[model samples]
Each structure stands twice: as structure tokens, then as C-alpha cells.
Target: MPDAKPAPAQALSAPQKALLKLGLTRDIDLALHLPLRYEDETRLVRLSDARDGQTVQVEGTVTHQEITLRPRRQLLVTLDDGSDTCTLRFFSFYPSHQKALAVGARVRVRGEVRGGFMGRTMMHPAFHAAGGELPDALTPVYPTSAQLPQAYLRKVVASGLARADLSETIPPELLGSLQRVVHGTWTLRDALRYLHHPGPDVSLDALEDRSHPAWQRLKAEELLAQQLSQLTAKRERDALRAPVLRTAPGGLHEQLLAVLPFALTGAQRRVGEEIARDLARPVPMHRLLQGDVGSGKTVVAALAAAIAIDS
Candidate 1:
């Protein structure tokens, strides 16, 4: 048998692993790489009971199904999950995948419930192999895009959860200290992986019923890294940006502004004076500009350009 396994993606990292429970996260492996808020999937309700706009599990035989191509090469599949049928739209479908979705099959659909005309229960269904009744609730939905199919996205997350080589960014002693301080149990890496793919869905008690110690660690580390990066960037700017030392008596500055074709406004006059003073000082000039919706900051900038043009 050929390797049905998909190809490799970006290696999982600490920050990514922490984001698993977030609905099909914007980042795929981030939840597994960082850490997580424990997730609960035991909270599933039947499709019949799922309300409009709520995520409901449709577990039924897919009796009637149809596929049609609309204008501009679009593919649409309408499916029924017993409660009611809804259109399952797929923008890009390969020849093989379409053949697999034909009618007369048992399938599960987890999708958002929507209201339809004539008070019919409808869903934007995601097809899957039908299974037994769900015993739990609060299924974590994921983010999806056209480039990545929801099925492929689900598989990648499942793969990341299955990986045992999950690295812990939080230190042991720090973890222990966190457990003692926060009065919680699980380490950082364990929390994130277990949330999306726990061996056994267990009840936890602590912050948000979470015993994962990695939340604080992950947040603190990421924040510190960002702060340090900012600080380093500021230091680099300090070294690289040279002060204008243009502090000569205001004679040359006045002469340059005098050459402008149009007369200057009071605001422009004030700004020019400020820039001239800032340049004369030993300190570097790093000015932020504010312009109204049509304030013409460009015109103001042009006046400064005249100085260089004159020089």
C-alpha cells in the first residue's frame, strides 16, 4: 500500500501547541508546540437538537445527495443528515473526492446550523464517516481556509497531538513552582497536547478547570521575547540614527523655506520651526506625523524636500 500519510509541514513549536483548543486555529501545530487550555469534546449534541448558528453534530444516513456545477466552475453538494438537508458547498473538488461523496452512505456532519426558507432545518455540512452517538459536548471547532481543507486541517491537528516528542519550554523547577504557586498540576507540554487529544477526557479543577502550568510560562516567555526584541530594536536605532546637528543660526533654514512656490500655513510654520530646532539639537530627530483625512501631510513633507533641493 502506498503511504496514505500526508507530507511534513513546519515543525511544531512551543507557541503553536498552546493554541490547539482554539477553533481550527489560524496556526496548525501551534497548540501542540506551546501549551493549551484543556479542551472538552464530550459535549456533543445531536444535529436534530442543534440550533441555528450553533455547531451541531449531524449523525445520520446521507440518503439524498446531489452535485452541480454553477457558473465560474463552482461545485456544490447538497446533503441530508435526517433532521434536514443542507447544501455542502466545496469550491475546489478533485475528481476522486467527488466520486467518494455520492449518495447512499452513512456520514457525520459537524457544521454551523443555519435557518432556511420554509422553516427547514439546514446545515452547511462537513462530511465524515458516521459513528455512534456522542457522549460529550463542547466540541472544539477549528479555523479553515480554502487552501487547506477542513479534513486535512483536522488530520494535521490529530497528527500533532499524536506526536510524543513534544518539547517543553517551561523548566522543571519552574513548572513545579508554578504548580505550587498556582495550585495546579500538569506541566506545559502535557496540557496543550492533552487538550486537543487527551488519552482520557478527565475533569480538571483550577483556573477554568485547567491544571496546565504552561499558560503562565508560555504567555510570560512570549511577552518577554517581544519586549526584548523591542528593546534591542530601540538600541539599534539609537546606534544607527545619527543626530542632524543642523543647529546653525536659523539663517539657512529661513532661506530654504523662503523658496517655496506657495505660502506656508501657521501649522506648517510651526512644524518647520520644530523640525529646525530638533535638527539643531545634539539628539536625533524621530518625529511621528499626524495628518487629517485630507490634511495634506505630503505637502508639508514637500517643504522639507525644498531644503535638500536648495542644498
Candidate 2:
């Protein structure tokens, strides 16, 4: 039988294109894109109980709505929760918004409430159809571009978090050591899930300051990955063969060290000798010479280069 042709790839949607622009092509990428902050939408507040300068979500019925031109064309909506009424103002709105927020429709709106000449008001608040069960966890507000809406991003991120392979890359023994250091027992998947949609009871301050167990786990993992990457690179370099660039007896390296204007410090001399020994070998040298400002690192480098040139 003849070999079958491969199926063609499907086109990406607008949201998918936006996700691609954000470098979120993989499920793992989406899972790792944590929220910038969280919003408490797990509970609702009465309109009467909401205070000025407080960000709150309230459910109410739209009693009256009108397009007023007094302040350069704005949509003014009066939302009544029976206890009190608040005005929902929108300077820039569409016909769809007017249709959705029609009079007598029950809606839940969230925004910072303010006291104005028009009584309690929320300027350009987010509103949706009311009566759905509130979320059990805080609403995560992720960093996003203009093309990608929060609703769409949240849905896709949840899907990615569920589908991504979250197996532990580090061994159990190493994880135990790290847990002891960080005093955290959270696994990679648990940390991600907790960070993505933290419970209402979790301390906001701890999360903000990165002192939470989940944050600690992520930090420890990131550091471990960086160390592993460096170790792998060093091992790969060590396996490669190179020309043995040895310093000959009384050659440029010796001449440079002997004739230098300033005397080499004990540390500098020790580092220089180490570099010399490494250069004499048949493998790549991967050593870093670190010192404070005004230290003799420059002299050590010059000495090493002299050995290289003589070889």
C-alpha cells in the first residue's frame, strides 16, 4: 500500500495569534504565565455596603439607562440592589453594551466605587449577566495585550494547566533537600495551580511579597534549572578536545610576569598559576576569575593571554 499524506495544519484564531505573540505556543508556557495580581470576585457586596474608593463587585438590576450628551456623550446606567442605587458610567461604549445593559436586566458589575455629584458611581465598570455561582477562588488578572481579553486568556490558561505535563524534573532526594531549604512541601503542579487561582483565604501579602510556599517552590525550581543548565554546558565543553597550549620555559608568560610594573598579588598569582595549568591540558578551560573593583583580574587575564599567544 502507498504511504498516506499528512494532514494539513489548521489556521490559528485571533486569540491564538495573540497568544503566539506572547511566546505562549506551548501548554507549558501558558501554565507558567502566572497572574500579575488577583481580584476578589468570589463574593459579592451590597451596593449600600460598598464604600467610596473601594473596588467591589455588586449584583443589581438596571433600573434606568440613557445616552446623555451633557458630558460629551456618555452612557449612564442606574443599578439598584434594593438597598441603594449606583450609577454605572461609560464614556466610551458600543451598541452591544447598551443592549446587554438594558433596563430591568440583572447584571453584576465590578469596579472602584466613587462618590460624585451624581451620588455613588463606578466609571466604566465591567458588567456581565448576573445569577451565576461565584468562583471559589480569587479571579486572576494576568498580564495581557490589547488583542487578548481576560476571559479568553483565563479559559485557555485553565485548559493549558490541565493538559500540560507537570511531572517533576528533579529527583525526589533533591526535591527533599530543596523543600527543607525553602520550608515548602508544594510540588511543581500544586504550586502552579495554587499560584494561578489562589484561594480567598491565602494571604495576599505573602503572595505579593513572594513569601508564599508556592512562590518559594517556583524560585527553587528556577534556580535548580539554571544550575543544571550551567553544569550540562560545562560537561559538554569538558568532553571536547582542544590544542594543549602550554607555556614554554622562560617564554612570554614568564617574561610578562617577571617584567610587570606592579607586583602580582597573592590571589592574582594563585589564579594565574591555575590558568597556566588548565592551558597546558588538552581540554577547554571554563574558569571564572572574580574579584572586587580595583582588583588584579585584568593582570591575570593579560598573563593568560600571554600564555595563549606564546603557544
TM-score each candidate: 0.47, 0.87
Shift of residue 256 alpha carbon in model 2, Å: 2.7
Q: Please, what are the lDDT tens digits per residue for candidate 1 over residues 156-197?
A: 676655654556555666767755654467555555544555
lDDT of 2 by residue, 269-299 (tens): 8889999899989999988889898898888
Candidate 2 has an lDDT of 0.92
Pairs with steric clashes in candidate 2? none
What does candidate 1 score on TM? Answer: 0.47
Find the 10 residues in a row with the least total lDDT in model 2: 177-186
- Best candidate, TM-score: 2
| CA shift of 148, model 1, Å | 2.8
